[model samples]
Target chain A: MEVIITKDLEKIYNPDTVPVHAVNGISTSFEAGEFTAIVGPSGCGKTTFLNLIGGLEAPTQGDISILGDSISTKKKSEMTDFRLHNIGFVFQAYNLIPVMSAYENVAFIMELLNRPQAEIKDRVMELLDAMGVGDKAHQRPHQLSGGQQQRVAVARALASKPKFILADEPTANLDSHATETLLDLMLKMNEKEGTTIIFSTHDIRVMNKARRLVKMDDGKIVENGKPDTA
Target chain B: MIAKLAWRNVWRNKVRSLVVIIATTLGISGALFIAALISGMMDKWVQNQIETELSDIQIHQEDFVIEEDQKFFFEKEDLERQLTAFANEIKEKAYRIKAEGLAMSAHNTYQVILLGVDPDQEPKVTNISNYIREGAYFKEPGRIKQILISQKLADELKVRMNSKVVINLSDIEGEIVGEAFKVVGIFKTSSGIFDESHVFVKNDEFAKVLKMKPGQYHELAIRTGEEVEVEAFQTELQQGLDADLMAESWIQMSPALKMTEGYMDTFNWILLSVVLTALIFGIINTMLMVVLERTREIGMLRSLGLNDRKVGLMFILETIYLSITGAIVGNILSFFLINYFGNKGIHFESWEEGFEAYGLQAVIYPILELNFYVLVTLLVFFTGLLASYFPVRKAIRLDISTAIRN
Candidate 1:
């Protein structure tokens, strides 16, 4: 099932003084359980497109429908609620709360969802173990290596059981070894849990790991298909 | 969960948070201590006056209160019997003959209020006996009438203890009577003015010279039980008195003290406003910095589904934690500081003369009520809430996409 569909999505910066079309008329959709990567050079509007889909920012024009509900029609506060209930995010820097332990970071999303403590505990441990970070559950983000922190971040994203996860450059800061580990953990989550994930990356290795790839340049998709075919 | 996050967030920057907490502690405690000092000073002044000069309650012939003439006198026997009925509330009662008179010595003459008292009964009602700086309170035994003059009057008249002074005053029949009295005691009180304007003599000798009977006394002073409500007791005593007489509590007799007591609350709030105002700014500055420093973290939380209200609540909780922690420590510190200084006393010996002129002692005992501490803590809590406004707004207004990039 298609979880996200963008219809001619657009975002313009400094529209009045000097309009810059960051995401110009993008059209796309992602199926559930697809480990998809949107690949492009720097400033190619990959993050903006993800943000539009995640309801983190409003598009100057066009509609982003997540599970058949158009997010462009929602108010700012309503959009925040929508984001909390339906979307989970993983940033390039692995933005896990520094003050929280890995377990706590994973549990935080479910807590925000108001899930029961017992259920949150079971789910958090399950996800942490799946990500191969169960033993590091009690360690804060600062105490973990880059790969471990990214794994924790993935667990946090999956904790909410959202329709899809939006990851922005999930491995840009990691070494090749850490990047390989994080990608494997994410691929495991995608296969085992059927979690639809759409991430933005410039790394060829990351694009290679994606089951599907959408290649972009100058804020428009140049290609979209299987990674090898694309 | 929000509270936990906020609390842990406060300690994220230990040095910055500690600076705010310590500043709040000093501000709140300093305000409370200053308030206690002033309160103690005022309370002690009124108490001292009531104990040493004006007994807790006083009764006089209505005409005598209106006009300070020797002719206006009360029937002592009947009034004494009436006062005894309140024995449970009235600890001690004394009757006195008060006259506007002049004390003449070889060197000088001074106008004074000549108070004729039964020394034994007078000492029971008032603490003047304890203030005797030289000799004893009417202790000399002689056919020559003995008197007590304040050290202030003694200095003015160039007389010492046992010096001879002449008492000249009006009798009840409006006749001028002159009599010789030897100063047996020289007393001093906290009030320099009270000391200079009053002289005491034996009631029998005073009455003999004035050609009056013991029953015709001008004033009746009663020291009531501390636990008794003074105003209510005064009203009850007044209702029980004869139509020709009137009773007054110390507050009624001294309106200035009453006014000062009323102003104390206003004074406390003013001091708290000054302290809390400073505290509010300190919190705002610190919290603004917190928001600025945690932009990316806050952005991450926001992007992770933390709603605007929850984000605002988290910052509010953080501000409250900082302020309340300081308030709790500040109040505890104030409690100990007030009690310590209250017992030890804070002396201003250099200003002794100025303080004494207004019936105040040089040393002041700091004091505060339990309700005041509770009030200050609540003010600090509200102050925390108020101080959180700008920071909460700043946090909630962050651009999630832009902040994440930071």
Candidate 2:
């Protein structure tokens, strides 16, 4: 089932002075349980496109439909609530709250959703153990390795059971081994939990793992198909 | 959880947070100490004036206070009879024959108010005897009429103990009369002006010199029981006095004392505001730094579904934690500091003359009521609220995409 649909989407930064077309005129849809990678060179608008889809930034012009409901018309406040319950995010920097332990960082989103304590605890530990970071659950972000931190980030994104996860350069700061480990963990979550995840990355190995690849240049998509074919 | 996060955030930059906390502690404690000091001084001033000069309440003929006229004397028997009804409230009372008179010595002359008192009864109503510095308080035997003159008046008149000072006044019949009274005691009080303008003499001698009838007095001073509310008692006592007599409390007699007592709280708040204003900027500066440094983390939180209101509330909570921690510590420190100083006393030996000029003691014991601690803490709490405004606004206004990119 199609989970997110973008119709003629566009984002223009500094529209009045020195305008930059970060994401322009892209229409696409992602299916549930799909592991997709948006691929491009530096400054080719992959992150911007992911941001637009995640509702982190409003497009200068477009209509976005999530699960058949239009989200482009939602207010900023409403959009935040929508994103909280529907879309989870992972940053390149493994942005777990520094003040929280790995377990607490994973549990943070569910807490925001006001889930029961027992449910949050079970889900957080289950996700951490699944991501292979359960032993590091009590360690703060700074005390964990980069790979371990990124694994915790992924667990946090999955904690609230969001409809989709949007990751921006999820492997950019990791070594080859950590990157492979993280990618394999994410692939397992996608297949087992049937979660749709769309991530932006230029890494060839990461792109190779995606079920589908959307290739972009400048601000528009140039290709979209099976990863090997694209 | 938000509160937990906020509290943890305060210790994130240990040195910076500690700096702000310590600054707040010193600022709040210093302001409170100064307030207590001023309160002590004022309390001493009011208490001294009441104990040594104006008793709790006084009654006089209706026109006596305004005119100081010898002819406005009231019959003492009438007030003595009415005293039986207020026996429980009345601690002691004394009658005084007050007259405007002039004192002349060989070298100088000054106008003074002559207070004629029965020495034994005067000590029961007021503490003038306790303040006698050089000579006995009406306990001497001499060949002439004896008087108690203040050291200040003696300085002006160039007289000493046992020196002859001629007092000139108008008799009740309106004729100018003069008499030589030997100065038997030289007293000094905290109030320089009071000392300079008042002298004490025997009521019998003063009445005889003024040609007044026996048992007639111009003023009747009443000392009430320590626990009695003077204002209420003044009202009750006023109602029982004869139509020709009027009763007044010390507050009515000394309006400045009443005004000072009323202004103290406002003065405390103003002092706190000045200190808090400075500390507020320090807090704002610290929170602003926290906001700027945590931009990426805050953006991450925001994008992770934390709403703007919660984010703002977290910042406010953090500021409150920082401020209240300091306030609690400061209040505890102030309690000890004030108590130590209250007992040991803060002496102002250098400013003794200046203080005595306004009827205040040279050494003051700091005092603060328990309610003041609660009120000051509330003020600091609100100050934290106020100090968080700009930082919370900045945090909420952050563009999540840009900030997360940072």
Candidate 3:
């Protein structure tokens, strides 16, 4: 099943002054069980594309239908509503709330969604156990290692039972061992749970793990194909 | 949840929050003080207006007050008969007989307020009994028909208590009938106008000297329970009395005195408004700084799926929390100062120069009363809320994306 699609996707960084086209004329679809990666250099619209697909930002000139709802025509408040219900994002900096411990950071999204206390506790414990940081649930972000913090971010992103996860450089702060561990977790979730994954990254390990790779150069897509070096 | 979050948020920047709290506390303190002061002044003016000036009723010639052009001299026997009947039914009365008399003393001769009273009934309806200083109240009522002269009048007369003086009563033929009087008492009424001019004599003595019929009367000193009840009593008395007699309550007797009180009340309100407005601005400044400092944190909360209203609720809750905290602290501190100074006032040495220079006998002990705490609290609570209102709006209206970037 098609979990996400964009028609004539275009995003402008600033539409008013010297409009900088950040995403231009892209058409795409992601399947339910795919692990996709969008790769590019700086200012090449990778973040812009991820923001659009996650419903965090609107397209300057295009359409996005996520599991069949027209996202672009949704009101701003409604677009945010869609994000809250169906999408979860991980930023480059891990973005684990400083005030919350690892367990609380992971449970934050579920709390925002007003999940039942029993369900939230169960889900948060399950996510933390899966992320291999169950023993460190009480540790704050600065107190934890970079890998542990990023794992908490991943746990938070997946806590709300979203249809897909949008992670921006989730492995950027980790070493090789930590990066491989986080990647393996994401790969296992995608394969076993059929949770679609869309990430923007420059990491080769992240790129190699992807089922599909969408590469962009200067706001326009240069490649959209299977990541077999073809 | 919002309240919990906002409370936690306040501690995020302790120094900044403390700054806001202190500034707001100062504002509350200032506002409370001024509101209390104004309300106290109002009570003082209202007290003086009613308790000191006019009595319950003033009995005069049927048409005397209206027709001052004709001296329709009071008939003592007939007026006394009516007064006795009035006294029988309503005991809150002092028959005050008044006449315009020119007095010549050692240093100064001026027109004076000569009041004649039943020495027995003087203490019944008014505070005149307490105003007597050097001599005792007329014990025999009719036997010791001596004058209780005012301190200022005594000073002008160059006479001490129990000194002999002569008062002249004029007849229809313009001949002066002088009578010797022993100054048996001195009245030092605190109010300046009364202290300088008023003199009291036994009613019978005044009648004997003027040879007014044994029962003539001019005015009535009447008492009621409270100042607010004066007008009610006056209106009731007016309805019962004959149209020939003219009656006025204190409010009408000295329109200027009442006006003085009314103007003071207005001034008090104006001063409180100015002080509280300044206080509001002070609160807004502190709260705005607090809101501006929390922009990034607020953005993070918004991104966590907290809606605009939840964010607004957090800020407003914090503001109310801040206001309530500050008001309590400030009220405690200010209430101490109010009590300390309310009872033992700060003397105005500066104003003494102006008062004495103008021959204005200074009021050395100006009483500062703080009986209206509820009024002060309510005024401060509302002002505190108003002070926080706009800052709350600004906090709520933050653009999350822009805020996050900053």
Each candidate: RMSD = 1.6, 1.8, 4.5
Residue-pair clashes per candidate: 0, 0, 4
- Order by DockQ, highest first: 1, 2, 3
User: For candidate 2 chain A, which ten residues in a row score worst on lDDT?
Assistant: A67-76
Q: What is candidate 1's CA lDDT for residue A50?
A: 92
Q: Of the candidates shown, which would achieve the greatest TM-score relative to the real structure?
A: 1
Fraction of true interface contacts that also occur in model 3: 0.10
- For model 2, how does the per-residue alpha-carbon lDDT over A167-215 read when each residue is reduced to its tens digit? 9999999999999999999999999888899999999999999999999
Which residue segments of model 3 deviate by more than 4 Å?
Answer: A94-155, A171-195, A205-212, A225-230, B56-64, B67-91, B131-133, B137-145, B165-178, B226-228, B286-291, B339-400
- Candidate number achieving the greatest lDDT relative to the actual structure: 2
lDDT of 1 at A58: 93
- Model 3, residue B124: what's the lDDT? 70
Error of 3 at B217 (Å): 2.3
Instruction: List where candidate 1 sits over 4 angstroms from the true fold.
Output: B81-85
- Candidate 3: C-alpha RMSD after superposition: 4.5
Local distance difference test values of all predictions, in order: 0.91, 0.92, 0.70
Query: How does candidate 1 score on lDDT?
Result: 0.91
DockQ winner among the candidates? 1
Query: TM-score of each candidate?
Result: 0.97, 0.96, 0.82
Which segments of model 2 are wrong by more than 4 Å?
B140-143, B261-266
